[model samples]
Target: MYASLVRSTVALAALCVAYPIQTQASDPAHESHHGKLGTVHFEVACNEAAQREFNLAMAYYHSFVMEQMKAPLERTLQADGSCGMAHWATALASLDNPFGWPGNVSAKTLADGAELMERARKTGLKTQRERDLVDALAVFFKDTEKLNHAARAKALEAALQDVAARYPDDSEATILYSLVLSANFNPADKQYGNQLKAAKQLEAVFAKEPDHPGVTHYLIHSYDYPPLAAHGLEAARRYSKIAPAAAHAQHMPSHIFTRVGAWAESVASNTASANADGGKTWNSPHAYDYMVYAYLQMGQDRAAHLVRDGALSNPTPPDHFAAAFSYASMPARLALERGDWAAAAKLPLTPAAGAYPWAKYPQAEANNAYARALGAAALRDAEGVSAELARLQALRDRATELKLGYWVEQIGIQTDVVRGFSAARSGDVKAGIAALQAAAAREDASEKHAVTPGPLLPAREVLAKVLLDSGDAAGALREFEAVLSKEPNRLRGMAGAALAAERRDDAAKARDYTGKIARQTARADGGVDGTQLARLSVTR
Candidate 1:
């Protein structure tokens, strides 16, 4: 088995060599920066073919539209095997944690990337800049078992920082450094220290080249935090226009749109993303996920239902990690958002064949478990809740084994929330309340998932529902408000707040909240259903 794997690895490395496209040097006049491609210098073997492919790969990489990079980088290698920097770029794209989370990479991806980097090292880069960047990635690939996640990430960040400084004229380097900084951002930091710093770096580049893919793309990342979301709106609006070919670029604007409660824009953005790649890219599933959410938020039930049904019936082999996660999470999200507890309860626990090995990433598994547990609790099925909690614990164990502390903690929070919801359903109010609150607190401290536009069920939203069920109107209102603060105009959060206010005898507050929902929904196509609106005494 080991020998077979090694042989396959060698075959993959040699595949690029089969399609060499020998060509003349590029015209010097055309070397100047263009609309979105910009002047990206990788200092390869100094051939036109090598430079062209390298720039294409860099363009995709800079925009975080990475899966598309493989072909171009492969071509670069084929054109000039000694264009070692092209190999390094390939490794970076192949190894990227699509979701921007620490410790989220699959073991297979890590090994593949490390193998590619080894090939690049053996081939040897032509420039000091390429060597430095390649060596930095080497740090991440080294002794995977020895260095902890933070230590490895910090080392890579340090290397990227040095590269950025070494090539001050290279906007691509600055963009890359900004990405590292943004990925390392902590949500609990109200100041968003790292994110702000990243924003400054990206914005400085954006000034000189408004259409630069990396500047627009990384700027979105830099301001993705809730506190800085407004700052990202411009990038979000422009990135797709600048790089329409990239599915991820089309979908990126929805990040800010979702944050700011612009459901219409979110829907449009993801729709473009889903279609841009003909629904074939790894980005398609992710685009569908966000599209469903946006449609649901707009109270366009039929649209949301069609989105979910279409994806489930026409299942694809989620070749990308983000696609795998989206495939796993979509059904659960649909059921939970619609308050269809029975449907969620019946969701299959195991991933479908061809799905990205989400089982290797505990967070993806936890999404399904969380939905199941919540569904079971809603149905007052203690046994079902217990079963799901066990599944969650097993997932936590896997994350622990992988040294994925973030996921371990996240799954733990879900477990607690499930247990608490179960307890509250069984009349253990005090313990249930405490546990649920703790879970919410823990979740709030963690960074948001960078892959999806937003989580289907924020922990605070769940806690608020629990409080409302227990008749703790004031407590429910507090939780709902917290959710709204982060996700303005969220449908369920708005409804919950209105309901809680009514229960608390705040008639004026209830009117205000319900009116907001009505106004928001009115702007949506066909508006919200009259019955769901009637539930909160909100009318068209």
Candidate 2:
């Protein structure tokens, strides 16, 4: 009997070690110098809710709910007596950012996030963190009034201050506070205190939870935006090393790696993702998207191998249209990059819906990506791209009818750019510039309210080409100035600007721009004439 009891006891201990009731760490009290216990968790949730990756971040949030069952409700409340972390996790998933994935936030994402937060608050949240988060949320969700940047910042700051007061040493609260501040940083200030603060908080959190995938991924992303070269690249590399199989691990990191000019590291990260976790789990399209984009970055074919073609076509899950649409359009994008218009045919204007219910999803990332992809791929053939343009034109009409200014304006920018390109190709220089100007106008209108403006780059590039073709050197200069102001390294734009300057007899400036473009693109040796411009350049 004694021997049997000992064996059973050993088995129980092994099970506990394998998977604890919550986290393996022994801090049941979750103490800080001042706060009671879980106050910081609530604050963390609030901060996370405002992030661009809130959808992906929320998947890992469910673990908090499972952990809460092990501890008493009272024990979970912290310095301000906020409820456990789960409430805040759900809440965070619910709030929408003013600017969202790429540049703009959709009404649907915002509504969903707001509704989720409101549900928790109404449920009589049992802690101070919950109350505080709710109060902050209330100010954020004011009905379609002014999209007041200042007001939102103030509310988030107050929540952070309240949470940080008693839990100064709490890593979660600190990280959340820093993220809120960083998101609001204005580059014109010449001081990046908030960005630095977020970076510091991320450093501290990663030290404690080095293996925490979310912390690692987000830390790398935070680094990519800042100008810090060494530290940011190192962090990006570290993040790739840890979460080698994250859904977007493959190509997304390229944005970071290329930003730092770490092409080798970027190539390695993409290769690692392709070789190791190409299809780790079935139906996770992001995995395939990452793999394909990574492969393309290394100059490999962009086709994803599934036993059945198109089975994994839409890699984006329903809740994450931004990623899914990006991945879904990769095949078509690759075809265009390699100048294979036939191959790009798969991404039609009216793209066939994927296996997922993305049409019902928020942000319409898939819809817009598919629409834009059509225009991008068909740029070489005016007639071919026209069918796609018509589709977008119809969508814009619908959006206008529905009073969806954001979508109407956005799609209009795309249509006008395409029209400008088409007009230039058809020997209508005057009409082309007019269309380009229209596109530019829409772009300017879109920027005022957009957080992640998608079509801006393409529009500017197209407009610059038209201005140069029309012998409008000054206009071309203004267009290139706008693009270079934001992205100074625009390869084609620089070349076009140089061409324009050369025509206007600004020999030195022309030489400088031309040299930069030639070095950037080895094949940029030819001069720009109406005929060469029409044939070599894409209309859309």
Clashes of 1: 0
| Cα lDDT, model 2, residue 220 | 50
> Residue-wise lDDT of candidate 1 within 23-108, one digit each (tens)?
23333224432444443554566479878878877877776667767877777877787777877887788656434545546567
Alpha-carbon lDDT, every model: 0.73, 0.46
Quote the positional error of residue 463 for candidate 2 in Å.
3.5
What are the models' TM-scores?
0.86, 0.57
Best by lDDT: 1
Quote model 1's TM-score.
Answer: 0.86
Best by TM-score: 1
Poorest 10 consecutive residues of model 2 by lDDT?
A: 31-40
Candidate 1 Cα deviation (angstroms), residue 535: 3.9
What CA RMSD would you report for each candidate? 9.8, 12.7
Q: Which stretches of candidate 2 lie over 4 Å from their true place?
A: 1-84, 94-158, 165-167, 180-216, 219-231, 242-252, 260-264, 270-319, 338-351, 354-390, 397-409, 434-457, 464-540
